[model samples]
Target: MSNIRHHPKTETLAAFAAGRLDEARAVVIATHAAICTECAQAIEEFETVGGAFLEDAEPVALRDDALENVLRRADPGVNVVTPQKPAGDLPETRLPLSAYLEGSIDDVAWRAVAPGLSQSVLKAEGYRPGVLRLLKIAPGVRMPRHSHKGEELTVILRGAYKDEIGDFAVGDLADLDAGDTHTPEAIGDEPCICLIAAAAPLRFKTVLGRIVQPFIGL
Candidate 1:
């Protein structure tokens, strides 16, 4: 993220390393780690550190049906559905490593929030605590300004959005924290689709912006 420092908190990475994050949320971060070497290294460090802790820990025996219960819960058929791709002409941008034709992100439900902004929220699939929303920004439209209550990671899907930090094209990931506050304008002729995993609802700083918050599902 240009002008914004959005490194995941140590605790978050630690949770991810421990198989504790929600499946869908984990998928998002996993995608991020694949593109951001810095985050990948951090995840590696977390895993390395976690492995040592695991080695030092004692094994506990599960009750009679505990294993069966876990197995049932872990059934292969159980998985989160990816949202469908928004139909529109999108500018050139980086898509996540997921399949372009069909994947986890090509089958969820999308809801409109504003004139050029729309989103689809996925069910939390694992230990993740917040909601994951896919946002589609219309071209040539600037989003309402806002700040986050917690951390937000935006993975560019199609096209680009620009702010004071700079332009983020396809595959570009922006990590924002509580201090970030900027309006993003879809700069290309086509629309921009971004995947955002956020723990808290966004706080629109302007009253007029806030008035539109409910409509935007932010």
Candidate 2:
């Protein structure tokens, strides 16, 4: 975590602190914040500022039935079960993210998308118009050059990779937006594994990548 050289942009963290980001993108931001001290501090600062702003805002009157409705929702006998946090140590999947996974990184059931490339799409509610997935690239493998239609957030979880943008290792988050294009190549001895939250589908540049796009659904 100490060597992390990349982080989400300030505006992205601000959106997260304000609870404005979509669930899938928020998960990626939270996962990165758990490991990166700098990003965590930045998020905290944003939260603190947001809290101050809220405190200064004018108050609005609530409906006469609001308090009664709240008490009814808070009743333990309502039969709604609140999810308990996972106990003890977390797996390599890390906090927040660990809650979303069945097990550690090695336990992922991957589907091969291309030679030396595998992926596992994560399912969760409230991620419409976007997707969350884990990608594993074998050492020496290079992803096809591509650009985004919207935003793409990628956090390295295992091994490392290098692209036109820069090198990325564990805990480093690459925050890219529309028009950004690069071909990432796994750089270490091991395969590079990353968690990605994409707002829209990628636009592959090469003919081979275009042909394979439908099959991979990336």
Candidate 3:
């Protein structure tokens, strides 16, 4: 299971078990769980160990017809929905950060996260504090070794990156936590583009980086 080095936090696994995550994020976690037995087992453990807490905060009992009412509105016939389409509308651009952002990576004002690093936060129409983050890694560069203060989830958008963990390519999702420390570097000829989300700030553990932590505002 160590082959699948990156994984989500136990809290996030609990959230997933409680059916609180949205469809898009849930798909990302589910896909990773499909390939990661450690995480999968961890999720099951959460289900077992945390079940009592959920039971204590009991919800009002549903009406006998509540399920029937829901099923009536949901699509029962599979043919009614459109078939899945491949993603391909993104433009290839000169600016390194602009290439992989969902709509306009260029539209965002880039922030200097570190000397050789920059970040562009993609704001949705109504995305709030803990929604989404798109990070661009400069070539020949690596982020300071650190772990997330909260659940940090990442999906590789373009190029590749690797740390002590395995390499990540487009479509690969990585789940990291406060327990994990990694220094990921952009690989090959291009800068790496990744989509990330976190509920808390990242804490850099390296002494040099920690000295400048206040200045860098990380």
Give the best candidate by lDDT: 2
Q: What are the clash counts of all predictions, listed in order?
A: 17, 0, 1
> Which residue runs of candidate 2 sit more than 4 Å off their true CA positions?
64-93, 125-128
Local distance difference test, candidate 3 = 0.66
Question: 106-152 in candidate 2: lDDT tens per residue?
Answer: 78999999999999999844646668899999999999999999999
lDDT of 1 by residue, 159-204 (tens): 7899877788766667677668878899988888887788788988
Give me candidate 3's TM-score against the actual structure: 0.57
lDDT of 1 at 128: 48
Q: How large is the C-alpha RMSD of every model relative to the true structure?
A: 6.8, 2.4, 7.4
Q: Give the CA lDDT, 0 to 100, for residue 159 in model 1.
A: 79
In angstroms, the error of model 1 at 73 is 15
1 versus 2: better lDDT goes to: 2
Prediction 1 global C-alpha lDDT: 0.71
- Candidates ranked, most accurate by lDDT first: 2, 1, 3
How many angstroms is residue 190 displaced in model 3 relative to the true structure, after the best TM-score fit? Answer: 0.9
Candidate 1 Cα deviation (angstroms), residue 120: 1.2
Error of 2 at 12 (Å): 0.9
TM-score head-to-head 2 vs 3, winner: 2
